[model samples]
Target: MKAMVTTGARQMVVREVECPRPASGQVQVKLEYCGICGSDVHYYKDGKVGDHVLDHDIVLGHEVAGMVSEVGEGVTDLKVGDRVALEPGIACGKCIFCKSGHYNLCREMKFFADPPTPGALQEYVVHPADLCFKLPENVSSMEGALVEPLSVGLHAAGTGDVKLGQNVLILGTGCIGLVTLLACKARGAAKIVVVDLYDKRLEFAKKLGATHVINAKKEDVKKRVDEIFNGEGADVVLETAGSVITIAQTPFLTKAGGTIVIVGQSAQSEVSYNFSEVIVKELTIKSIFRYRNSYPVAIAAISSGAIDVKQIVTHEFSFEDSKMGFDTVIEDAENVVKAVIKF
Candidate 1:
């Protein structure tokens, strides 16, 4: 098996490594596609995401899907030929959070590509069979890889409790932002407004079902949002841009008694926000770490034609050109919505 290792910032090399075999209750998957996430780009470009710095060589991929090549003992549900998406985070099932069905908050989670845990950027990765959700014949392997990020969107919309005929304001046009738009649209949001600096990404958002698109670079965000929402503000405001400015703009953009979901992780920890606006409006503020219990829902939504996850892909690269893929994502951030490595 071959693995793409990140030796340093913006440095990557292919190395022939030992193939991992599945242990008990696990399955060995022949990886087909691995999506490059924002965090992956952060690690590749700056060698860190907040405090989680890259101290050593690491494989940089977590959103992945593949076919099962071998099933270990006690793995009964998945067979050798089953196509599945591996949920990247493996939590310690005994924690209070895990027991309470909040496994994404489990303190002892060994998530793939999170520092010490090696990611699934190689040819073969052995994952727990229970974490591998089998994909239906109607869903492609590429869509399977997307389930991971789609889960975040599902979780965000579900947290905000976006209902039919409700209005939503997503503050970003990145991959996560577009997926959140799809989630809000699938949940029957009447009006979806997306905000971003790049016109290309905003155009992509419009194609993905955003009723209104606002380029913050060209026009004022608060003014456009007010006009679009009839001076009321959105029922649900989701911050997916991961920008400090956008994060601070959430309270002002949310409607009175509405919900504000913080979906993006900002590089800076502390943000100056208007808590007075939150209190005055009686708005609800919620945030998600990653996602929990959303893979099945995302897969079902994709299968039912409620969400077209495949439309998010703007670029694709072969496994051998993985470095080039990462470079393109960094250099052409505005044009590339999502890039996947095909093995």
Candidate 2:
């Protein structure tokens, strides 16, 4: 089997590696497609994201979908020839977080492409049978690969408690932001205002049902949101840009008693935030750490035609040109919303 390995910053190579066999309660999948996430881009360009630094060569991909080649001992429900989307994070079932169903916060989480754990960028990957969700007959492999990010969007909306007739503010137009918009619409948000510096992404967002698109470079985001909400601000604010500026602006952009969900993981650890306004307004601040128990819901939404997850894919690359896919994402930041590796 061939795997795309990142040796250092801005370095990647396709190298032959031994194919993995699934242990008990696991399954071996021949990967068909894998989406390159923003975290993957950060790890490729800087060799680190916050404290999770890439100390050694590792495969970089987590959004994955493929066909089951073989099922390990003790595995039931799923069998050979089943197409499935894999939930990347594996948690310690014995931990309190896992027992309580908040496994995304488990202390010992082995997430794909997160430095130590090898990802599905390779030709084949072995994952827990329980984590490999079967794809509906109507969903394609590429669409299946998108379920991971869609799950993140679902979790963000759920955390923010987005509801009907609420004004939703999204701070970015990237893949995650667009998916979050879809989730909000599915949840019956009346007005969705998406903010981004890129006009191309903003245009795409508009086509995908964004009620309004604001270019942060040309317009004042706070003023625009104020105008839309008649100075009351948005009911739900989701910060997906991971920018220090946008994260800090959440307090001002959110309405009194509104909820703000931080969906993006910032590269910087600390940001000077305005605590006085947050306290005075009585706003609720929440954050998402990957996602838990969201993959199934995302799949169901896509299957039911409630969400169009694949339209966010603006680029694709063959497994042999996987490095080029990463390069396209890095260099073409404005145009390439999402890039997928086709195996």
Candidate 3:
């Protein structure tokens, strides 16, 4: 088996590695596709995201979908040749967070592509059987790979309590931001406004059903939002850029009683926000970690045509050329919204 390993900043190599076999209650998947996430690119180019530093080489991918090739002992739910998408995080079931069903925040979790844990960028990966969700007949492997990010969007929307007839505003039109847009639309948002500095991404958002697209580099974002909602700010504001500027501006952009969801993780741990404004308006501030129990919902939505995950994919590369894929994503940020590696 071959795995794409990141040795250092802006460095990636494909090297042969031992293929892993399924352990008890686990299943080995011959991975078919893996999506390149913003966190993956951050680790590749910066060698670290916040405190999670890459001290040694590690495989970089988590949004994965493949077919089961072998099943380990006691794994009766899945068998060989079952098409599945891995949820990527394994938590200790004994923890309070897991016991309470907020396992995404478990104190001890082994998440793929997060430095120490080897990711699914290789030809084969062994994952716990329960974490692998079966894809519906109408969903393709590529769309299955997209389920991870869609789950993040779902979590963000759910956290904000998005509802029909509510005006939603999403900052940043990256993959996560676009998926947030899809999730809002699926939940019957009255109108969605997407803001980004890139024109290509704003265009993509419009095609994905955003009622209004604002180029932050050119348009006055605050004025546009006010105009769209007739002086009242958006009913729900989602900050997906993870930038200090965008996160700090949420209070001004959201309605007095609206909710603000922080979906993206910033490189800096802390940023100054207008707490006084939030207190005065009585706004609800919510934040999401990765996700919990969202893969099944995302899969069902894509399968039923309620969400079109594949439309966000703009580039594809073979597994052998995985390094090129990462390089292209970093160098061509304006054009490549999302890239996937096929095995």
Candidate 4:
């Protein structure tokens, strides 16, 4: 099978690789679509994100969906021809975190797109049958691939414990931020405000159901957030930009007693935050490391017409043009929200 391999910085070469067949308790999926995520772009361009540097050849594309072509000997639940969206992280089910139902933090996890773990960028990928989520009739393989990121939004909203009639602020209009906006609206958020410097992304956020959009490049983020909240401040502030500035302002943009959910990757730097302010406001600061026990809900939401996962995919490229697809996203950050590669 042909796979996109990142040999080095900003380099992706589509080379033939030996396709792994389904092992016992696994399923071989003939992948149809895989979303080129921001992390993939970062790895392709910067060769790293946070502390995990790319030390070897890596295949990066966790947001993937496909059709089952074969099932392993012990697999019972799924069968051949079933459409699926793979929940990329395969956790060690026996870890303390996994036993406590926080498997995303499992000490040993083989997440796709992460270095050293070959991802689903190839024509076929053999994944554990348990992690393959069956897609319904209403959802396409492309939308199915996007269930990964949508799960993050759901988890972020879940951490905030969002309820009906609660005003929410999302700091970033990137893919995760837009999905978070959709998730908040689905959960009955009273008003949604999305902040970003890019106007194109802000427009996408508005289309995804943001009540208000703020351009951090032009307006003071906190000032506009105050105006939107009637000088009181937001009930929930979700920091999804991964920028030091945005992470620092999370507390300032949120109201007393409100929760702040940190959903983006913070590039492995210890950014100074006002912990004293969090103490005084009695704010609940929740952090997310991918998602656990949320893919099914996100898939169901998209399948049932509750959330439009397909809209997030703004660009698409074939498997052979995977390099361009990944490069375009890194270079054209303003226009491309989500880019998918067709296999």
- Each model's C-alpha lDDT? 0.95, 0.94, 0.93, 0.90
Off by over 4 Å in 3: none
Q: Which ten residues in a row have the lowest lDDT in candidate 3?
A: 261-270
Over the full model, what C-alpha lDDT does candidate 2 score relative to the true structure? 0.94
Q: Estimate each model's TM-score.
A: 0.99, 0.98, 0.98, 0.97
Mark the regions of model 2 whose C-alpha exceeds 4 Å error after superposition: none
Question: How displaced is residue 331 in candidate 1, in Å?
Answer: 0.5
**What clash pairs does model 1 have?**
none
Candidate 2 matches the true fold with a TM-score of 0.98
lDDT of 1 by residue, 1-343 (tens): 9999999999999999999999999999999999999999999999988889899999999999999999999999999999999999999999899999999999999999998999999999999998999999999999999999999999999999999999999999888999999999999999999999988898899999999999898999899989998999999999999999999999999999999999998878899999999999999999988999999999999999999999999999999999999999999998999999999
lDDT (Cα) of model 3 = 0.93
Error of 3 at 124 (Å): 0.7
lDDT of 4 at 5: 86
What TM-score would you give candidate 4 relative to the actual structure?
0.97
Model 2 Cα shift for residue 82 (angstroms): 0.4
How many residue pairs clash in model 4? 0
* Candidate 4 colliding pairs: none
Runs of candidate 1 with Cα error greater than 4 angstroms are none
Best by lDDT: 1
